[model samples]
Target: MATLEIKDLHVSVVSEDAPKEILKGVDLTIKAGETHAIMGPNGSGKSTLSYAIAGHPKYTITSGTVTLDGEDVLEMSVDERARAGLFLAMQYPVEVPGVSMSNFLRTAATAVRGEAPNLRHWVKEVKGAMADLDIDPAFAERSVNEGFSGGEKKRHEILQLGLLQPKIAILDETDSGLDVDALRVVSEGVNRYKASGEVGVMLITHYTRILKYIQPDFVHVFANGRIVESGGRELADVLESEGYVKYTGSKEAAALS
Candidate 1:
């Protein structure tokens, strides 16, 4: 099984005077066929952590390392990281007014696979993936993410995940705007991708709804730029029942008691 290891990672954003630190001494490991959930409130650096690992230019890795399958991820470019079997479905998918979804996904697949996907095979595969995600095949002809609803955008991300077939997928707040039906479709797409036994998932979100379908092996709580607590799937349930205020252990919460 492939492994993704984040060892003592410290991250910050680029700025003139001084870099703004986001991730602080974070460490975690995920392996093939496993699922991990990172739960946190807004501004807790959960998305920043994913962006840094995926080599996004906006997030600078000040220290530590991100290695995937024993390869140094920090040394690779964003595209190189994707080619090396790492994928990040953005929290807010960008709109490309000129590019059709079909073209964009095909180009990404070709790049990640290092060769052109067989025409007939790729078409069949894409069709199946689209159908599974409940995405209208007609939408593929439209410009990528142009005028797409929140649910549609999330499903499109999953479609890319299926077509690219990466070893690890980092989903950043994918459930944010999804309704019940949309959430089910997104979850099914993830499950289908997981069936291959080659994909490890790191689902980053603030809500617990998606956890019911993904069934994470490990659930971590991120706050103050660090993972303060972690446990098995039941941890997610605990958070669902009690909410973040209780588990976050804020000084305000302590003082109120």
Candidate 2:
């Protein structure tokens, strides 16, 4: 089984021409078939952990080691990380104007798969995946995420997830803008991808609603800059009831509440 191990990760970003630390010695291990829910308040550096692991240029990994099945992840480029079985589903997926979703997805698949998939089989595969997600067939010809609704964008993220089939997936607030039905469809897509029991998932969210659909094996409470508490699925119920007041203090938690 694949393993993504993070040890004493410290990350920083340039703010006001100075380095500002975000992640303060985070340590976590995710193995295949496990879903880890990272729950935290806003500005708690939850997204930072995802971006840092995916090698975002803005966030610098000052100290720590991230290894994918024992391979150094920090040494790889953003695209290299994807090819190395590390996938990141962004909270806000970007728009690629003028590039058709069909073209974009196939190119990405080619890069990751090391060769272009057969056109005959690729079309059928893409159609099947899109149909499973309740996506319109016309979307294949549309510019990537351009003029798409919040739900549409989120669905496409999961579409990529299903197609690429990476070893480890970092999903950043996938439930942020999704409505009740959209949330269910998106969650189901994620569930389908991880059903193989060979994928490790890091699901980051502030609310526990998504957990209702895609249950997590582990729940982690992130406070300040690192994980403060860890537990099982029941911990989400605790968070839903008490909120993050216990971790972020009453003042900060109240503002978010």
Candidate 3:
């Protein structure tokens, strides 16, 4: 089974004066078929953890190791990470002004799969996935995220997840901007992927609303750049009711003990 292991991860973002450490000695492990939800207040380095695992250049790993099934993920390039079965669905998906959804999906699938899919079957697969997500067939002709609503963009992210089918999928706030209906649709898409029993999901978010739909197997409370508390789905309930009052300030103090 595939396992993503992170040990003492420290990440920094270059600021105006110096590199600001965002993640401090964060350690996490995700296994196949497991869904881990990382919840924390804003600026607590939740997104930073996702980006660091995806090996975003902007965030430097100052210490610790990240490995996927024993292979050093920190040494791999961004595209390499994808090929090695890691995927990141950004909080804000970017726009590709001229790339059609059909073309983009096909190209991405080709790269990840190491060969172009059979044209006849590929079209059917795309059509089925889009329909399942309640995405209109017309979207196939539209440019990726170009002039689309936020909910539409998030749906498109799940569209990619369905097509790519990575071993570990890191979704950074996939629920943001979605209404009740859209959230349900997108959560279903994710649940579909999880049903495969071979994909692990790391869903990072601030609110527990999405949790009602996604139902993470494990809930991690991230604060001060580390996971301070972890438990079953009940942890989310506690956070919703109690808030992060215990972990809001003094990140250093919170993580140390």
- Decide which is better by lDDT, 1 or 3: 3
lDDT of 3 by residue, 166-188 (tens): 99999999998889999999999
Best by the lDDT measure: 2
TM-score winner between candidates 2 and 3: 2
Q: Can you write out model 1's per-residue Cα lDDT over 94-150, one digit (the tens) per residue?
A: 999999988998899889888889999988988988998989999989999999998
The parts of candidate 3 lying over 4 Å away from their true place are 249-257
- Which sections of candidate 1 miss by over 4 Å? 15-17, 247-257
Candidate 3 achieves a global lDDT of: 0.92
Per-candidate local distance difference test: 0.89, 0.94, 0.92
| TM-score sort, best first | 2, 3, 1
Specify the poorest-scoring 10-residue window by lDDT in model 1: 248-257
Give lDDT: candidate 2, residue 256: 34
- Give candidate 2's error at residue 237 in angstroms: 0.9
Ranking by lDDT: 2, 3, 1
> Distance from true position, residue 29, model 3, in Å?
0.4
